[model samples]
Target: MRVRQMAAPLGAIVEDLDVRAVDASTAKELNRLFCQHHVLVFPKQQLTPDEQIAFAEHWGELIPFPYGSLPGYPNIIELRNRGKARDVNQHWHSDMTYDPTPPKLTMLYALEAPAIGGETAFANQILAYQELSAGMKKLVGSLVATHSAKDLARLYGQDPDQASEAEHPVVRTHDESGEKALYVCRAFTRQFQDWSRQESKALLDYLYEHCVRPEYQARHQWQAGDLVMWDNRCLLHYAVHDHGEDPRLIHRLQVQGTSPV
Candidate 1:
């Protein structure tokens, strides 16, 4: 397999490989590329739900999404447009951060996509953390943030009051690579631990905007045969919903991860 850089900050496109048949050596190389690049796109591939699960298993155990999953596949989440106004994925985030042990990686295989305009964008938080001013880095290093599932809970018709919440360090170190990354995001992170939202808003908003700056981001235009996966341990992603009412279907799965340090 050959790997080509997708963007300067992060992402790589793997060529000359078939997802349905990854061998042990290829799996080992893929894992190294994944930890180094944070995102990988495998184009022109057909993967059934079972095949996708098999590919994901090379990395770690699968985690069932909180809301629900595909009828027969308990670990695969089916993604589609829910209208622009109510789209839960439009905002930037790492998957399921409100859980004490959020997923370490998320994979998506497009079964159907619009002829135009359904894209996903990713931000490299490792680069975001590296570019912060020394003082800012020192401050964030000493901080912890609280993440909540209230917005998603409400969107799914569940009681927001019953949503799960968890606290994670503002700067998390990757368990495998030992690299530091900014871990807070606009979607779930409510406030710095021990600080009121009112007091934390300015700084939090600054970081929310800072982490996704164009220089640190890459975008992927979806196609029916694309299999894309990203490391949730060091990145934030946004699903663009500009395809109007056109159909877009994707099967998604997550790899279990440890609590962020």
Candidate 2:
């Protein structure tokens, strides 16, 4: 497998690695690479739903999206917002934090794209955690936080009545490498547990700001057949909406994982 760095800190374009069909050995190596790199981008991989799901299964169990399936295929999550709808991932977030066991890995396959923009940006949460002071790390290590869709909906100008929250460790250790990451994001992380409302807000806001520093991020521009897989546990991502008239469509598959911590 050939891996090319897209940006200095986070992104990589993995070429020559065949995702269409893989041997057991290659699949194991790919999983290891994914853990180290955080984000792996396939420049031009055209895969059907079955192919995508099959490839995802090589690493872990597939997690069905909460909102049902794609239009034609009810199994895949349609990550498109064209014409009237437009792309909705304008902010940084880890997917499905509302669930007790949020998806550990999220794979997105590009179907269509515009000439410019719609690039996805990823931040290295592990790096974010590593950059903290020893004192701050000790303080955060003893804490836990609540992640909720209700908090996210409110940020998106939607009501929070339908959303639910899950408690996750403030500092999560990666299943494979045992690397600790700051398990927080702007989307679902409401506040630190054991802190008052005011204290929670201040602490969460500080952590969120620190995790998204520019030096720890990489942005990937899309190609029609590109397939990207990211570790949702140790990274945060944002989809940019730079395309105006043009449209972009993608299919997403998620991998099941234990709750944070």
The lDDT per prediction is: 0.93, 0.83
Positional deviation of 164 in candidate 1, in angstroms?
0.8
TM-scores for all candidates: the values are 0.97, 0.92
Which predicted model would earn the best TM-score?
1
lDDT at position 200, candidate 2: 90
* Residues 131-171, model 2: lDDT tens digits: 99999999999998887787556655777787777888889
- Per-residue lDDT of candidate 1, residues 221-260 (tens digit): 9889899999999999999888888899999999999999
In model 2, the clashing pairs are: none
The stretch of ten residues in a row with the least summed lDDT in candidate 2 is 81-90
lDDT of 1: 0.93
